[model samples]
Target chain A: QQQVKQSPQSLIVQKGGISIINCAYENTAFDYFPWYQQFPGKGPALLIAIRPDVSEKKEGRFTISFNKSAKQFSLHIMDSQPGDSATYFCAASSIKAAGNKLTFGGGTRVLVKP
Target chain B: DVKVTQSSRYLVKRTGEKVFLECVQDMDHENMFWYRQDPGLGLRLIYFSYDVKMKEKGDIPEGYSVSREKKERFSLILESASTNQTSMYLCASIPGPNTEAFFGQGTRLTVV
Candidate 1:
């Protein structure tokens, strides 16, 4: 069973527009939600993350809006740029089992056209 | 900055060959992980080590084994390489359970 499900396997957005990627989880025990960005031939890097307690968390141009009741979280990129084009992955994990057992959603490839 | 390094960027092996993939981290982190990325399946964990000489099986650990003799180095061994094992393997390390993980560039393994 896929613990986490992500939408829009591929997305195309114009530069300066907003880009959004959504993910849903079935496990209520999951407390940590993180998004990762991966470029071709490179490993994934942490982009932004949010805990269950917070409804929204923003860092610079990246924002993570989470709905605990809905069991959904989405990553919103403000003023998307061509440099932001990469594959994004949404992951969920519980603090008790967070060592390296993150449940990842199928990646979404985003293309920001300049 | 934390740095995780995989020994090889690319590797090729025969079906019956024994393969070893080595990973080293500079950050003195206590946790290390090995995951494989496929075209549509995304990243799936194979094994992880919480500390020296300690290992845990991840979701997919059927054809893999891990060894952590030192705190900084972790190794993944394939007893017998198979064509299905061909994929991009990534190594990661985290300071603690609640913290973010740093990843290596990844090693692309191709089994013939």
Candidate 2:
């Protein structure tokens, strides 16, 4: 079963507008929630991450809003630009003796029109 | 900067051919992963290795095998190429399970 579920497989926003993507998980043991951004030809890069202890974490134009009670999280891009168009993935992980095994959501493709 | 490098950017192979995709990390990371990217499917883990000479199957390990002979190198082997296996393969390495990861540019493999 897919542990993490993401919504809105694709998104489109105008320049200067806000772009949002949502994800939900069934496993509460997950302590780390990270967001990754991928360009057309490049690998996915770390954008922002948050833990269950905090409700929100912001980095530049990218923000990760997490709700521990609801078992849900969302990524918000403030003043979205065309450069922000790319694929975004939300992942959940819990550390283990060997290492942390991450479960990723399907994905969200974002398009910002300038 | 920590980096993960995949051997080939693009490769084309014939059916029934044995295909090897290599990944090397300069970060000396203990955790390495192999994933395949498809439209809408996101990144699906195929295999992972936590240390040298150790490997574990991930969510979609069917028809795929992996090797971690050394700490810095992780290889994914396709016993026999199939058209269905055509997709972009990505490799990632992490210092620890919960920390940030370094990813490779990806290898676009086409099985004809």
Q: Write candidate 1's Cα lDDT for A11-110 as tens digits.
A: 9999999999999999998989999999998999999999998999999999999999999999999999999999999998888884646888888999
**How high is the TM-score of chain A in model 1?**
0.96
Task: State the DockQ of every prediction.
Answer: 0.70, 0.80
Interface RMSD value for candidate 1, one decimal?
Answer: 1.2
Per-residue alpha-carbon lDDT of candidate 1 for residues B6-81, written as tens digits (9 for 90 to 100): 9999999999899999999998999999999986577889999898998999989999999999999999999999
| Fraction of the reference Cα-Cα interface contacts (below 8 Å) that each candidate reproduces | 0.61, 0.72
Which candidate comes out best when scored by DockQ? 2
Give the fraction of true interface contacts kept by model 2: 0.72
For model 2, what is the error of residue B96's alpha carbon versus the real structure, in angstroms, after optimal superposition?
A: 1.2
Q: Write the per-residue lDDT of candidate 2 for residues A39-109, one digit (tens) a residue.
A: 99899998899999999998998899999999999999999999999999999998753457677899999
